[model samples]
Every structure is written in structure tokens, then in C-alpha cells.
Target: MRSLGVAVAYPDPGVADELVHAVEAEADLYLALDPARAAVVLAGEEALSTLGEHPADAAVVGVAADRDAIAVVARAALRCGAHEIVLWPQDRAMLRSIVRDAATRARIGAGRAEGRIVAVAGARGGVGTTTVAAMLARAVAESVVVDLDPVGAGLSGFLSDGAEPTLAAVVAAVDDLDPAALSAAMAGHAAGRAICAEPREAAPTKQQAARMLALLRATVPVAVIDAGRAADDAAMAAISLADQTICVCTPDVASIRGARALIAAAGRGFPVVLNRSARMRLSAKDVARVVGAPPVAVIPDDPAIRRAGEAGRLPSRGAARRAIERLAGLILAEASDGS
Candidate 1:
């Protein structure tokens, strides 16, 4: 684990050294004059008055030798963003535990700074956008599939069936979502995790959708969003927030034209995935020229895919499965490289 930048604000210099040494290996513990940059800040009761104001997000700890003094100092520290209060000497073990936990979380958060939110949008219906998104999600270690298509319900059945909390419930409380709440809301599948959106039901605003995606990426390795055929504000918000936007399309005339228009609307440099290219009207290169975007992946048509869907199973082996796995690898590799 990487070390965390911890700041100790104590009146007595000797006591500060003791606190710092307790968790030195886990954190680059020091007495910080600037509390803004520290991941965890230990504020003694007497020193609490010195920290006028600091970042609300930083984990602040109140330290005091006297039990009565800890309560008094904690109340003051709370106004300055103290999340934990501990009595010194008596609570040294607990204090070290808290600091170590905070340091571990800080390291995790820093690592998650590279998390990617990829949006898979279809030019028109039946282009296998949801399938591509789900497959790519399954490739990643920790991934969440957000089904923004209210009508398709493809994602709802893509994963393992369960009566988990729906996306609607999560959107209702978008302003107050925690890690536990989000994990509970998402339905588990053998392939990966999914949060199915309600049909024809509008709950999350565009801003809320952005926040939800951001939170998901913060918690998970990747967030694969199936933005369906809907071009609503919420869907647009998802595309806007995505680290990469992939437009899925077949090589047919209508699919090509629709894909071109969707890519143009989405903005320049957005990649396209030529899916179901068995009886194609044009090649991947031609499709790219027409769409004005390069083809990031090409998934061949396969009857086994349909059979797997009917059997409630993902394609275990075949050209389509292999292609999807390759596409998933490409997407994840690109994300890793960029990060």
C-alpha cells in the first residue's frame, strides 16, 4: 500500500511526535501548517482552535488527553470537518486504526483516480449496443453496467435475475448515495453487475445522472453505460461525462447513416464499433469514412449469440464471443494507456 500524507496539529511537540510515529509506516505523517493537502489531519483539542477552516472532504481527527476535553474539542472540530474524535493515550490504538484506515482509503481513492466511465451508444435499435457494453463490463475486474435505455430492457435481462433495488430507487436518492447503497441497488449477474432503469419512468435529472456516474467510477474500476437509443437529456449527460464514447452500428445503409449522424452529434473523435458485420453492405474502413470516425472494433454476426440469449447465457465460445472479448480488451487497454 502507498503512504498517505497525514498532518498532525498538536500544541505539544513531544506528543505530536508520538502520534506521528504510531502510524509512520502507513503514512508520511508530519505536523502540517497547511491542512488542505493532507489526506488525514489529527487536530489536538488545544490546536483545534488554530485550524480556522479546511477542506470538508479531508478526514479530520480530534485528539485529546482528557475525555471531557475530547467532547468539547470534537464539537468545535465538527464545524471544521472532523469526522472522528479520540481520547489520547487511552484511545491511541483506536486512533492508529482510524488513521491507518483513512490512509488505506486515501491510497485506494488515488488509485481509482484512473477509473474510466465508458458510454456505449447505438445509432439505432437492434445494433447490439447493450451486448457490447455488457461484454466489455464483464471483462473488467470490478465494473457496473448502467442501463439508460428505458424501453430496451435488454440490460435488465442481460445479467443474472434478481429482485435487487432498481436504478429508479438509486436516482431518487442520488443526492445521498454511499458505497453500500449503490452496491445493494445494482443487480448481480454472472457476467458482471447491472442497474436496470425503469421503463418510461423519468427520475434522475441530467445533473443527477452525471453525479451518479461519477460516484460509480469512484467506487468501481469501470462504469459501462448502455445509453440505448434515447437521445434525452439524461442520455446526453452520460455521453458528455464519459471518458470515451463508442457508437455501435452495423454496416447496413441505414445503420451507417444513423451512426454517422449520432457520431457527429456526439462530437469529433468518438469511436464507432461495427457490429453484426456478416452480411454487410460495406467494409469497416468504408463505414469509418462514411461515419467520419474510425472503427475501434468489429463484431461478426453469430447465431450462437441469439441462442445464448434465449438460453439466458453469455456466449462461452465462438467467433462472436472471441470478438467481444477482443473488443473488451481493446477498450480496457486503451483506458489503461490513457490513464
Candidate 2:
């Protein structure tokens, strides 16, 4: 483990001394003379204005005098991008934990090659975006899925054991998000790992969404994000960050119309996947004509897929699995070429 540099700034002389002492007590922490170069910054209310000068990834702590002062500085600290607020002398242990976690993330991200990001979004609700994203991730080696849907069946419910420290906890601590924090939030899946969304929880801000994706890029070889219908900031952020965006829709008229609208709204045409294409009058060419892009993959409706998903796994041998495997190969090839 690498020692992290910490810079402290407090208006009160006594509080400043205590903070310095606390930093010195930690073997993995050291005082830095410059705030811009430090890995962690301890800033008082008066010092909040200078936070903008520090690195964007730097862990910022707002020092509060007591419980009363916390309320006064909490909103301001949040606006100034402080990761957490700690009371002097009382929350020393919490401060140590925050700094150490930041250090660990910094060490892990250092010199790591950023991974390929793929976003799968539905033309409308119930178009199988989560299924496609999860299956594609499963087909690829060393991949992880992220659920950015704000109001849908959670990805973990079907793929994972519904573990704690979910996306709700991650967005709550977005500013302090690190590789370790993200790893803790993930639920292990047979396909890979997943950060499941909490449908009832508030959506992450654009900055929070971007930060999460950036951390994922640093932590894994491939990240597949289920953007649902791209109705929220997190979904939009994933689409924007992805190396490839796959727009999934069925062969029905409503689904094709929705895909057209979504593509128009995005101002760019994404590769289309005609999912559940069966017994419909519209063909792949018809969808291609309407969406302005040829269908990249057409997955047939398979009952086995639904059964396997309900059972918390993907179909082992079926046409659905074969189609998903082909899509995964295309994504991997694109990622390799881009790399």
C-alpha cells in the first residue's frame, strides 16, 4: 500500500493542530504542503472556496466544529464537492477510513488501462434491455454489468442474490466513490459482477454517473451498462461514455416507432438489435429502413431465455444464447479494434 498525501486547512488554530495530529497518527498518511498535489484535502467552511483548485479526484473532507456546525456546512460542502463532513477530534476514525479508501483507489487506478464501455438501451420499457446487457456481459470474459435503470425490475433480482451496498449506497457516496467502494457495491453473478439499481432510490446526478463509469473503466476489462430507456441522467451518461451503444427493440410497430424517436433524440444512430423477432410482419430490413441503420443482431423469442432468467442464470444452450454470443463477439472485436 502507498502512503497518501493529505493537506489540511482550517480557520481555527486549535482545530488545525488536531487535524494535523490525526493525519500524523496514521502510518499511511502524510501532510502535504500543497493542496493541489495532495490525495486528500481537509477543508474548513472558510477553506471551501479553494477546493476547486484541487484535482477533481482528490478526496475532500469538510471539517465541522460540532453537530450544529455540520448542518450549517453540509449543504455548502456538498455544493463545493466535498466527499464527506467530519467533526474535529470526534470523527477522527471516520476521517482515517475515508483517506485510506481514497488511497487504495488511487493506487488501483494508477497505470491501469481503461476498459471498453458498452451501453444497451431499450426503445421502450419491456424491450429486454437488461436481458441483452446481462447476456452480452456473460458472453465476454472479465466483464461487469451496471444497472442504470431508475424505475424497472432491478438487474440483480434476476441475476444476483440481491446483496447489500447496492447502487443506492454508491450514489449516496458518489463524491467519495472509489474502486473499493464500487467493488463492495457489486453482487456476484454467474456472468460477472453487477451494481444493481435501486428503483425507488433517487437518480444519480450527471457528475455522479460519469464518476461511476470512470471508476468501472479503470476496474474491469469490459463494462456493460443497462441504460433501460435512457430516461435518467445515469442512463444518458452511460450512453455518452460507451464505446458502442446497442439500441434494442422488438419487431412491433410501437417498438420501431420508439426506436426511431430514441435515435432521433440521441442525434446519432446506434447499432440496432431486433430482439424477440418472431411472428411479426415487420422484417429486419423494415426496422433498418426506419432506424437509419441495419440491424446488428436479431434475437428470436425463446421461452427458455425467460425461464433461465427467472432461475437466476442465462440459457445454457439455445438460439437466444447463440445470438447473444454473436453480438458479444462483435462488441469484443470492436473494442479490440478501438484499443
Candidate 3:
């Protein structure tokens, strides 16, 4: 496993026990305010300026003098990307909740940046992980690509050929694969770009999956696996191998609750993309409250995407396309910054 890339800055050791716990054994924190460093821990509004010094992925906590000042601190903390802001008046219970939320967002943003492996799974069914995955697959796939879902799921039909070449072929060629070779095996997009979306009820084994993913990454700047409904060990392994995972959910209570676990299961990092959101059922704020972190991006309920799938056509260059393209840019930018 890669090191948990984290950076934390706390000037005072007032809460030494909690400080140690915040770092966690597996994570490598960039503690900015330690005595060893010439760091002076700033408080409240001043801390926002310090954000540029910290890695974009690091979770920051702004310690204030008291609870009453927390709201003021939190506003600045949000601007600084300081995930959480805390006050001495508060106890661990409330503080921990706030801190955890910020830390999780920090982790998620960082994870997705480096071609993060993500599994877009629906809570139960009909939650649209497939469609979300298919659109996202096109969004991230640049050079080399891998679509884990099988043909006939619109990914194959609309984005690429259903029967020509698939991720299955890439898996078969794993032993001798390189970036160029893997790129060759994927299905091509509108601009002659390639993708690997082979549907198999039994996905590749974990080790096999990892090796293939590693190889695919070597050739393609991005590799997207459409996990489909098969959220098995192999699929989980694929998701784990990813630098970040994107859990797709709807606004319904069931989808929200399921998305919560899916995001959590992806570990401390990985963004949650709310798909087909319904304001009547639940708002983005409601989803955020459930998931604890604001969704990296919220996609509205658009039937055109489904219609495009049924017609075996890529989503038109309309509202959905504009949103998706922008979403793609955000995802790619995040990838470049290692967020």
C-alpha cells in the first residue's frame, strides 16, 4: 500500500493525546507547526493564508481559544481547505466529528488526483452507478483506458464498440502488457481514443487485477473500470488499487445511506459523485449531511443521459455534456495536482 500522504500543522501540544491519534499510524502527516520547523501556528482568519504552504490533500485543523469563536474560525478554515476547525471549549466528541469530516475530505481529494482507483457502486440497485461510471469513464479516459463493465451497458454501445475489443482482452494480455499495448487493447472513443470495457460476471482475481491495473496505468494517462453491479473482492481490489474511488449515489434515503458506507469503505480518501439527484427526495445538503463531506460534484437528474444510452449514442453536447465536460476537467485537474 502507498503511504497515507497527509500533512498536519498544530503549533501547540495542548491536546497531545489527540494530536498523536490525529496522525494515525498509517498516515504520514506534514505537521507544519512543530518546534523543529520554523512554523508559527496562526489562528482564525490568519490561517487561511497558510493553506498554500500545505499540500492540497492534507487535513488541517484550526484550534481557536473557545467554542464561541469556532464558527468564525470554521469559515476561514473552509477557505484554507482546513477541513475542520476546533475550539478548546469543545470536548473530543464534537471535535472528533468535525475533525473526521475534514480529514475524510482531505483524503478523498488527494486520492482521486493520481488516477485514483474508484468503484462507483449503487447502494442497492437502479442507483445508476453504471451510467455514472460510463459517463465518468469517458470523462477520465485520456490515453489508455479500461472499462470493467461488460458490453450492452451503454458504455460499450455508446462510448465504444460492443464486441470489437474489450477489457477482457487486456486482462488476457496482462502478462505481456505495457502502456502502449494496453492502450491498443481498449475501445476507442469519439476522437479515436481507447477504452477497456469488457463485461464479465467473474472479474479478474485481486492479484491479477492489480498487476493489470499497474500495467494499464503505465500506458494510459488514465484507466477507468466500470465496476457495474459486481462489487466483489476483485472489484474492490480494483477500487483499492485506484488512487481515488468515486461512489455514485442518488438523493433517496436508501441511496444516501448506502453511499455513506461505500465512501467509507473506499477508506479515508475518494470523492463521492452524487448521480441523478432529486431535490424532492433529498437535497445536496441532505446528502452532504449523510455522507459527512460535501460531494466533490453533484449531477442533477437528467433523463437525456439514459435516453442517449438507450439509443446507443453518447450523451449529446447539451446541458449534460457541458456539465460532464466541466466535471471531467475538475477531475483531471485534481489528478494533476495529486488531489
Q: Which candidate comes out best when scored by TM-score?
A: 1
Best-to-worst TM-score order: 1, 2, 3
Q: All candidates' lDDT scores? A: 0.74, 0.81, 0.58
Give the per-residue lDDT digits (tens) of candidate 3, residues 57-147.
Answer: 5556676756676777777776765655666545444644454344444444454223344455555567766666656656664533355
Q: Which candidate is the best by lDDT?
A: 2
TM-scores for all candidates: the values are: 0.80, 0.67, 0.59
- Ranking according to lDDT, highest score first: 2, 1, 3
Q: For model 3, state the Cα shift of residue 288 in Å.
A: 1.2
Model 1 Cα shift for residue 86 (angstroms): 6.5
Error of 3 at 191 (Å): 8.5
Weakest ten-residue segment in model 1 by summed lDDT: 104-113
Badly placed stretches (over 4 Å) of model 2 are 1-113
Give the Å error, residue 310, model 1: 1.5
TM-score of 2: 0.67
C-alpha root-mean-square deviation, candidate 2 = 8.0
User: Lowest summed lDDT over 10 consecutive residues: which window, candidate 2?
Assistant: 104-113
